[model samples]
Structure formats: C-alpha cells, structure tokens
Target: MKLVEVLHMNGGIGDISYANNSLVQRKAILMTKPIIEQAIRDLYCSLLPKNLCIADLGCSSGANTFLVVSELTKTIEKERKKHGFQSPEFHYLFNDLPSNDFNTIFQSLGEFEHDLRKQFGEGFGPCFFSGVSGSFYTRLFSSKSLHFVHSSYSVHWLSQVPNLIEKNKGNIYMSSTSPPSVIKAYYKQYEKDFSIFLKYRSEELMKGGKMVLTFLGRESEDPSSKEGCYIWELLGIALNELVIEGLIEEEKVDSFNIPNYTASPAEVKYLVDKEGSFTINKLETTRVHWNYASNTNNENIYNNGGYNLSRAIRAVAEPLLVSQFDPKLMDLVFQKYEEIVSDCMSKEKTEFINVTVSMTRNN
Candidate 1:
C-alpha cells in the first residue's frame, strides 16, 4: 500500500476504534486528572493572574475535554479560596485537528453551560471558550496570551509521515528481517519531528508557562524487543495473512511499517533543555493496561467491554484483513490472538505501555 494509504487506514482505525473507546477514556482521565490539577495550582500560585487564560492542545471530542476543563475550574476555585483572592475570569481555548469531532465536544459544553453559569453567576467572571482547529506545532494563539497549556496523549503523533520513510526506495518500515537501514530512517524521522515540536511549543508558550503531556514510549533502546510495542507484532501477523490471501502484494506488505518514536525520559530532558525555553520539572513513566479481562475470574479468556487482546488485534489488523479474509478466517485470527495473549499471560505480565512527561517553560 502507498504510505498515504497506510496513514489514512491507521488514522481511521485509531480514531474509530481506540480513540473512542470508554476503557481508554476512563484510564486517561484517571491518569491525567492529578497531573492537571497540580499544574493548574502551580500556574495559579506562580502567575496569580486575575484573569487566567489556558489552552488545551489536541483536546479531542467526548469526555476528555470536559474532564480537563472540570479539573481546571475546580483547581482555580480552590486556589482562589486558599489565597483569599477572588475567583478569576477564565478564558479557555480547546484545540484539535480540523478533522476531529468538534460537535461532541460542543454538545457536552452546551449541557454544562447552565451549571457553569449557576456556579459562577452571570458575568460574575468572564468565561470565554473558543475552539481552534489547527496543528499545535504552528502558531495557534496570540503572542504571550496564554498562562497555561495542557496536552495529553497527542504529541507522539507526527505532523506528517517522516521524510525518511517517504524517501526509502526499498521496504522502509516493513521487512521480514530486521533491517538496519529501515531502523536508521525511522530514527532520523523521529529526531526531525521532535525538534520541530520543541521549536513550535517554545514559540507559542509564554515565559514561566507550563505544559503537561503523555504519550506511548519505550523502556529500552533495543529495537527488536517487544517492549517497544506488542501491538505492532500482532499487526504484523495479521498483515502476513493478508499477503497470503493476495489482497495486497507480498512486497507491499513487507514494506509496510508502523512509525512509532519512543524517547526515554533522559533523552526527552535533553531535547527540552537544548531548546533553551523549557525546564523539565517532573517526568514520570507509568504503565497503563489497555487490555484487561472483563471478569477477573475468567482466566481462560480476556474481555473488557467486548474489547480484549483478540478484539484489539483485530482492530489493528482490519486494514489488511477486511477484503482479504472471510469472516471465518477473521474469527480464526482473533482466536490466534487469544492464544498469544493467553500464553503471554501465563509466562509474564503486561504493563507500562504509556509515558507521561511534565515540563515548565522557562522565563
């Protein structure tokens, strides 16, 4: 498949499948709330703005945006009371890609409008909320207009496919055998993306402002290990099946690759420090289990809201599997995934799939 085709397929699959799921939403909320609350407190205590302006970059649809806004409002109120100061007016900017589902976010906000007015009273404090659609890497706000910025589970995404992947003549991302050339190209792309991200964020953020972000990361530098991402391996197996069925050419399937960039905490710190605009205040990496058994008692099978390892495997494989494989074959693929997970569970544990990093823009 063409690179663009692969990107479209993967992006669509992620949005419809993983991004919209309730299990991921619940886990994201729990993991992010505390960090957001603390960041708000720090922003308020440090800046003490009578009118606070905050921006949430990559604030996708559904409960995620509301969860962040709710926590922020509570933090602002709490800090105001603790400092014996009047509540400040809040101006919030919720941003995401232009293609994101803004309707859902807007609908949720509309439902809470009455409640918000009741709590703060009509014009008790100026509350302005606007939705901005654009790439976060470029200018999204007026100069020095923001006091706090928050982004979660979004930065790892590259603005575009890495240039190296585009340039590679041979199998860039996919090969039956580990190819050093492909790995080098992937890292070069990641480096370029990371640098661009740092520069963009530095330009947008005001002095002493703060940003909190979380993304998928790797624990080891080793590229061959499953520690980087088991999901990729699972998808590879499904893709091989598609090749056998001749839905996609074997060469194309072999050339297909997942563009994942994982930076260690130390590496991240170096990048930020070199940018000369941010200081790493706190960085912590934690493991979040995306797959869990619906019933803790069911040892033989795993299910969570009808999404288990089998379901997840299928979701990732659907791009290559749909036209190629029949329903029965698809079922067999899921069964195979179940066996893989079962064997994995028997031998070891699954944890630490995501990384959370928090930083402050230097004055």
Candidate 2:
C-alpha cells in the first residue's frame, strides 16, 4: 500500500469521523500532559531565542490538536509566573499528512486564536498558526527553527508496509500467526523510520530544544506480542468474517496490509542511542483499556464499550480498509467488528500500551 497516498483518519464531523472518535488519543495526551509540561519547564530557558518556534507533528485535525498547543502556552506561562521571567513570542505550526483536513483546522483558527488571547490575555506575544502538510519522516522546518516539538500516537505508522511481508497472508499486522521473518521485517522498518525521525528533528531543533513523543508500544521485545497490536488482530478477524460471508474475495483480503508498526521500549532507546543526536530525558509507558472505560455495569460496559470501541477503530482504519475492500461494505464490516469486539471484551482484558518519551537536542 502507498501509505502517503492512502493513510489518513476518516474526515469531517460525521459519526465515524476522526473528530468524533478520537477520545482514546485525546485521553492519551492528557494522561501524558505532565511529561509535556516538564519538558517545557526544564528546557534550560536561559538559552532560548527571542522567538520560540513550536511544532506539533501528526497534528491531525480536531480540538486535541489545539489542546496540545494550549497546554504548551500554559506551561510557558507557568514557567514565567514561577521564575519571574518573560517568555519569547510564540510561532506555532500544525502538521499532518497532506491528505489530512487542513480546512477543518484552519476554519477553527479564529476561535483557537481567540481562546489563546482569552487565556493568556493581551500580553501574549504574536502567537501564530501555520498549517504544514507533509510526513514528518522528512524534514519540515529550517535548521534551528524549532524550540519544542511534540507528536502523539503517530510514529508507530511506518512510511510503507514491509515488502518481505507481502507473502504473509490473513494478518494485516504483526500477529501470533505471523512468521519470524514477518516480525523481523516490521522491526527493521521501525528501526529505520525512527532513526530518520530522530535525525531530522535533531537537525531542525536548536541546541537544547526539547521533543516529547508518544505512540502505541508493546511490553516485550518480541514483535509477536499482542499487547501493542491486538486491535489489528481483531480487525483482521473482522475482515476475515467478511470473506467467510462471501461479501469480499479472500485474495483481496490477502492482498491487504496495514502500514503501521508498534515498537518496543528497547527498540526506541536503541535507535535513539544509535542516532547519537538526542539525549533521552524521560521514557515512560502507560496503558488504557481499548474500551477506554474502567468503571461501568456489565450491560453498559459490554454494549457501549464494544460499539464505541469499534467506532474509534473505524475512524483510524476505514481509509485503509476501503482501499482494499468494497467501500460500500464499510458499515457491514464495522457491524461485524462490533460483534467481534463484544465477544472479545467479555472473554479477556483489552488494553493498549502507549509509550511516551522526552528528549533534548544535544549541543
């Protein structure tokens, strides 16, 4: 699959749109807010330039996108209030794949800017917004332009599917049924892509700039662990059900694969160390139930959790699924998806491991 051409969240404000279904990502950001705040707080502010350039990579359209910036501004304000110093002017850039809905974000800018002015008041210096469209794997800024950079739930997406895995059938991602070779292909991809990501950020970031990143992660070094990608396993199961019903061709399903990967914490550290550009300041992991709800009655839990979980997954996977399967079958696919999730949730715990890291660009 051509990831840059096809990979994007479902768009606009419909029931299945990313805007409505990104609670899990939103919660993940909030859960890790402290890491972001500390990264900003400990930036050795004595050396910052007069203009503070900030960038949010993979800043898919929605309220969460601006919330990331708002939090940064708040952290900056907090530092000024606590240390009795003034903050530099802010220049904010929101970036995502070219296929992302920049219109949705730009339309909200008036309100977004107003909110910032209301929160920070008249003293807030020249906070600017520019929508940048491209993959973060490539350098998106001039050298020494950025003081802080943040990306959430994005690095796990590989630039493209591993070629060797073209022979692997049935599974769209790493699974228990995958061969040792398939596992290695994914590992290799993550290692290379992550290395480039670090390298580019290192070049663009001014010396002593901070980067805070988060993505889906696994608990074990073994790539076959479902801890990071069980949701894809369930998605594969859903697609197979469509085949069994004769609604789609088995070969079509076999020809499809998700252009994504989940890295283990060890792999993340290894690439960062090998790249030798950034010093790791904080690397931490957290988990949230796939359903994203911990307390509820069994009936509400089973019904609401399964349905909502399927919707959330749909928002992320629908674009890829439609490219391979009949677009008309999306409704049926997620219907079966909900059933599969309901059955799976009742049988076992369904949670996802998320890794968040903080680093400083070396001098």
Candidate 3:
C-alpha cells in the first residue's frame, strides 16, 4: 500500500472520529508535559529568538492538535515573565500526510486564537498558525529554521510496509506467533525510518534546539512481547474469525499488514547514537490502559471497555483497513474486534507502553 496516501486518522468530530476517540493520545501528551516544558525552556534560553519557529510533526486534527500548542505557549509565557524577557512571536507549523484533514484544523483556529488572547492577555504571543501538507520523513522546512519540535503519539509509523512478510499470513503485526524473519523485517524498517527522521530533523532545527517525542514502545527487548504486539494479535484473531465466516477473502487478510512498529528503548538509543545528530536528554516509558477513557463523562456512551477501546483503535486504523478490505464490512469487523478486546481485558490489565524521549541538536 502507498502509506502516504492511505495513512491518516479518521477525520471530523463524529462518534468514531479521532477528535472524539483520542483520549489515550491525550493522556500521553499530559504525561510528557514536564519534558516538553523543560525542552522549551532550554531552547528559548539558548537562542532567545524573537520569533520562535516550532513544528508539531504528525499533527492530526482535533483538540489534541491544539493541546500541544497550548502547552508550549503557556510554558514560554511563564518563562518570559520569570526571566523578564521581551515577548517573543510564535510561529506554529502543523504537519501531517498530504491526505490529512487540514480543513478541520484550519476551521478551529479562530476560537483557539481568541482563547490564547483571553488566557495570556498582554503576555500572550502574537502567534501565527499555518498548515504544512506532507510527510515528516522528508524535509518540510528550510534548514536551521525551527527552534522547537514536539510530537506525541506519532513517529512509530514506518514510511512503508516492511518487505519479506509472506511468512506472516494470518497476522497483521509482529504477533507472538510471527516467524523470526517477519519480526526482523519490521525492526529493520523501523531502524531505517527512524534514522532518516533524526537526520532530517537535526538539519531543520537550529543548533541547540530541543525536541520531545512520545510514541508506542516496549520495555522488553523481545519484539513480540504482549506489551508491544498483543493488541494486533487480538485484532488478527477477530479478522481470522471473519475469514472463517466468509465475510472477507482469506487472501486479503494474508496480504494486509500495518505500517507501524513499537521500538524498545534500546533500539531507539542505538539509532539515535548511530545517526550522530542529536544528544539524548531523557528516555522513559509509561503505561496507559487500553480503555482509559471509559470512566469519563462519555462512560455511558461507551458502556463497556471493549467498545471504548475498539472505537479508539478504529479512529486510527480504519483508513488503512478500508484501503484493502470492503469498507461496508467495517462495522461488523470492529464489533468482532470489540468482543475480542473486551474478553482479553477481563482477564488481564491490558495497557500500552508509551515511550517519551527528549533530545537536543548537537552543536
């Protein structure tokens, strides 16, 4: 599959839209807020640019998109007040795949701006917001233009599906049953994609600029550990059941694979060191439950943990699934998936290991 064309979060503010189903990602952002604040403070103190150019890579639409912006601005304003520095202009560039829902993000900017004014008052930055359409794997900004970079719950996505996966039939990701070769292929792809990511970001950021990124990762060295790959294992079981029912072609399941990887902390450190661009500041993992939002006000809407988790996964995975399977069968597919996920949740505390890394460009 052409990942750049097919990969994107489900758009709009509807029931299954990413905007509504992204509480898990929201939690990750909040978890990494202190890291982000420190990065911004360090970057601002080093260069003190009058106009701070920041990029939120893989910035899909919705409240989560704005949440990152709000965090950065508030921290900078507080620092400026404490240090008695002149007010700095803020330039934000929101980037994602070419097919991302730029319209939704643009439509909400007016209210976002008004809120910034009301909250920060005279200390508020005269912030400028623009949408850049393209992949972060490639260069999107001029060299040495960006001052700070922030991405949460992104960057684990590989640029393309890994090769040499014919042995991975009946599975969608690096599941426990996947052959060793299949596991090797996925990690090799991640190493290549992440190295390229570091190289390009290093060029875009000014010397000493800081970055903070959070994404799905595993603490275990084993690539097929349940902490990293069990979610896909359950999804595979759901799809195999559909195949048994003859709702979709068996060959379709065999050929379908997700273009995402969950790297271990060691794997990430190795690539960053090999890339020779950025100095690692902090690397740590935190666990987030699969159905973290079920206890919120929307609890009645979800009613069950299985349904809550299913909607969250569907918001992120539907676009890729629809490209290969019949879009009409999505509701049925996810219903089966909910049953599987819920059943597993009852027996264990299913959680995702999220890795948050803070880094700075080398002088």
Candidate 4:
C-alpha cells in the first residue's frame, strides 16, 4: 500500500515514537543506548576485522538516526582502543518509508557532519552513509551485505491491511467492543508482516550478523485487554467527537480501524522460533515513560509513550485541527481530552510506558 493509505488504513496516524523533546523519551533512549552499544560490541567481537555495515530500518526523520550512529561509532572506537587495533570502517545506512521526512534527517546529519568528519578524520577509513527509502519488509539492499541491523519503534507495523478484518464484514476492530473476529484479523496481519520481516532480514544480513529491535508490544497473551494501549481509546474519543460535530459520518468512522498491532513477548518469541532465522539473544520488556508537555506539574498525563501515542495521535489531530475544526473548537477538544485523561493518570500513578525487546540473527 501507499504510505499515506497504509497510515490511514492501519491507524498509524501518529509519529512512530514520542515527540523528540520529551524528557521521558530522552531518558528511555539513554537507558537503552548502552544496552544497544553492548549488543553491537558483542556482535562486532564475534566478527573478525571489526569492520561493520549497520542499517537502521524505519529510521524516521530527526535525532534518532544520529543517536544510533553515535552509539555505534563510540562503541566501536572504545573496542578498538581496548584491542590496540585500528578502528574498522563503518557503513551506516538509514532506511524509512519514502513518504517520511527525509529532509529533516538530512538536515540533522548536516549539522553533525563536521563533528563526524573530525572524529573519523578524512581518509581514515571507508565510512559510508546513505539513506535508503522503502518498506522494511521489501528489498532495499543487496543480499548478505548487512552485518548488523537495528530497528526501533518499527516492525509492529503491517505492510498491508488485515485479511480477516476484511472478510469479517466490518464486525471486528471497530470500537471498544471489538469481536473475536476482529482480534483474529489483527493477529493474522501481524503474522504476515512479521514473517515478511524475517524473510527480508534473513536475505539481507550476512551469516552471523545480528539485529537489535525495539517496538511497542503487549505483556499479556490476551488480545482483548485495553490496559496497554491508549491510542485506540483516544482515537475512539476523537472519532466520537468528529461524528457529533457532523464533520464525518458515523458510518465512515465505524468503517475505519487502526492498522497497527502489538504482540506479547511470548508471541514475538514464537514468531522468531517459527521463522528459524533469528535467535533470541535477549528478550525483555521494560516500561518506557514518556511525557509530552514540558510542565510536569500538570497532573493530567504523567507518561506519554508506547503504541506511538503522542506522535501518532498528533499526526491525525494536527491536520484535522487545521482543516476540519475551527480554532476555538480544536482548543476545546484538546482541553477536554486532557481533562478526561488527567484523572486516569493520577489514579494509575504509573510513570513508565514502553515495551522493549532485543534479538540477534543466527547463521
């Protein structure tokens, strides 16, 4: 499917991660960065020469790309120093959907160009950087070329619409009362997407290459629970408001469903085991706390991460706020959402809001 169509169809309406300025997101990155570096080091140590070709899939625009590269480079440098060997050359490729904001990523890289050059030095090694735009589940690189692959906040996304949902005649995934058929349809799509992801990665990564990935996931095996996902609830509220305002027909809203799915850690393990390409080096889920507003004093929403809540909702909300709702009405809607969610936040009193998993590729 086309990028916009895929996003609209699947409910990937928000940014894949929280807003960049979120302190909670920054903290999560800081906590995760070291682990990622350690994984790269372990993988690099297993390989001779230490020259690594790394790819970050679904690396959307902004500082995230630089964050991964910075961690990888520094780790390699430290390892080189410890071994008393010359630093290996680095080939860093960033991949995302064609519709993503590449200009933003390019601009961020430009800002860091001088610093990167100074660190690597001209003619020091074959350091290559390129942006490859395409679906992660499709061909984007030569076979057996990548040494390490990293994707964060990606892969939970399906490459296409769910088949069962279509066959079910609109009974599933419509509202808070999604039927079993709807849930099955969602899983079916996830299965397909994940299978394609494994196959693609298996083809692109060389023997013994490693992959580290982090995405939104469920802790529970049960699919019907609403505990972990706030995006669906928020979307339901937004659609209800839109219907009440007569901006969109109730039938149209009912026909639409979020095109995203989350798997439990066990379910993810199952997929990997079944695929037989990647081995589970380490798989653990940790709560990631994210905050959108800078004013932490506001007790309405404490943590704002996972299920791509802040970014995904803003993607849909910002455009609708501009085109569909009047300025005053949009302001009121935002306020109402905050008011409704604030009490829940206080009641829950939980801060962390993410699920992270890491893995490796087997020869």
Which candidate's lDDT is highest? 3
TM-score of each: 0.79, 0.96, 0.97, 0.82
List RMSD in Å for every model shown: 4.7, 1.9, 1.5, 4.8
| lDDT of predicted model 1 | 0.63
CA lDDT of each candidate? 0.63, 0.85, 0.90, 0.63
Best by TM-score: 3
Off by over 4 Å in 1: 1-22, 115-126, 165-177, 292-301, 304-306, 309-347
TM-score of 3: 0.97
- 270 Cα displacement, candidate 2 (Å): 0.7
lDDT (10s digit) by residue, model 2, range 1-363: 467877899888788888888888988999999999989878736564567788999998888888899999888877776766666688999989999988889999999889888988756677878989999999999998898999998989998888764456888788888878888888888888899999999999998999999999987887878797688888888889888989988888776777788887788888899999999999989988777732346656656887888898898989888888889999999998888888889899888899998999998
Q: By the lDDT metric, which is better: model 1 or model 4?
A: 4
* Over 4 Å off, model 4: 1-26, 117-126, 164-176, 290-312, 315-336, 350-353
Over 4 Å off, model 3: 295-303
Better of 3 and 4 by lDDT: 3
lDDT of 2 at 273: 93
lDDT of 4: 0.63
Which of the two, 2 or 4, has more lDDT?
A: 2
TM-score (C-alpha) between model 1 and the true structure: 0.79
Total backbone clashes of candidate 1, pairs 3 or more residues apart or in separate chains: 2
